[model samples]
Target: MARRTGLPAVEVLDACESTNDEALRRARAGAPHGAAVAAVRQTLGRGRRGHVWVSPPGGLYLSVVLRPGVARECLRAVPVAAGLGALDACRALGAKAPRLKWPNDIVVLGPDGVRKLGGILVELCLGQRSAGAAGDAAVCGIGVNLTRPRGDGIRPKAVRDGMPAPLPAAYLDECGAPAAAGDYAAAATLFRDAIVRRVDAWAAGLWKDASAAPLAPVLEEYRSSLLGLGGTVLAVTPEGTVVGQGTFLSVDGTGRAVLALAGGGTLSLAPEQASLRPLAR
Candidate 1:
């Protein structure tokens, strides 16, 4: 796909390491931006905080190599753009409504409550360059649930809305979903487009507007998909955890969540290590 777009593409089968790792390796070896690497199965898939990204067959796992010349502080926005991509893909498929919970988790609500639909991980590969150099690159890994496994571990709160959820809505809304074996393919396309647009916008130095522009459309879509936003919730982090009553304000330019705390404090959280769950007040 990247080749057709004038970008490079690479594919691997049964990779022992993660796709992101391989992409990073290639990037360090002078792979240009927009290069993509896909794997059939990853033995060491990873999630936030180095957690294992469980990968079984029937799922989509791939990574994209990007070299965006921006300050390190602004790098956090990649995941936000990724989440938007996923949400757009879901919307295209008929999700109609999908909310991005801070960081990179895609959340959808069913009758039960909020359920995770997919996730993204952005890994920054440090290169041999000066602190102020512009040679650093990042490899973004995306995983989506296509066909639910039979015996995989299931979180009690996790909900699977099935692939049909988006198709019906797509038929009614856009006439048809993008052709693919499952939602994973559709999601990959969405992520790719979002990344391209965001990176191009950033490259053109349209930072402020690009950062704030996505909030409105994303929030509008999130409002309908999110099960809980303005409510008491527990914010879990690696350092510890905090219980607070607040509303999910909006995802900032750096991808940090601007959360309004209950007492009076406003917190900007890097959602990578944080989990938000509703608290019973």
Candidate 2:
């Protein structure tokens, strides 16, 4: 049996289209905060910008419903908090120096290079507003590759322009977490606990005085473990347009990517606005 955390309810399924989809459906139906849905495999798994997430049976797919009636500015930090939570879980499970890729990706550095271990997606479902509060429910979805799929099994399919090419997928098993494999329920529970724990703290801080500044500690923690700080990178929009190319700096108070442009200007992009990619020197 999996140990319970702050979650109110947990549903484990053999397979689902996507845990985020199911969790959103429940949230709309008035499911209370802290409800979680996890599946062994996802048929229609998706990442940010509707990119397909290859969800094999060996991975952990989970989504948690959060109803933190804070303002939009505070809500923007959800991904940052969730990313830190995922990083903590990875570290707790013995993966060394797993760093957060801005906005959503959790990656591990290896001898060859950086390889992705998992990713997060946060989707908001707005609720009726009353009494000067922002009524919103966010489903924080996370996916971690615990073991390499068989042939195309656990290996992640990399994005290719016009040809078929796949990169070697990073696995928790290979990163000193062999214990996470062969146990879907336990792994999902651990992920939910770790992620929700940070979100809980973030929400509490925002609710206290209705200010985002108090949550600066969370932002700094994220900044410390952020991958590619000081590296040249491109902020690409979902349409594949280059929004900005600059040196990576720390994220701002509201969790926006701050960059130092070459032309003596700065750019700050929201998580929903663009995806960051490394610019090869």
lDDT values for all models: 0.57, 0.78
Query: Looking at model 2, which ten-residue stretch has the lowest summed lDDT?
Result: 159-168
Taking the tens digit of each residue's C-alpha lDDT, what string does model 2 give over 197-278? Answer: 8888887877765644634748768888888888998787766678778999878776778999877799998777877776
Cα lDDT tens digits, model 1, 115-142, are 5656678888766657532677777787
TM-scores, one per candidate:
0.74, 0.89
Q: Candidate 1: minimum summed lDDT over ten consecutive residues — where?
A: 163-172
Cα-lDDT of candidate 1: 0.57
Cα lDDT of model 2 overall? 0.78
Winner by lDDT: 2
List candidate 1 stretches off by more than 4 Å: 10-12, 128-133, 153-190, 205-229, 278-281
How well does candidate 1 match the true structure in TM-score terms?
Answer: 0.74
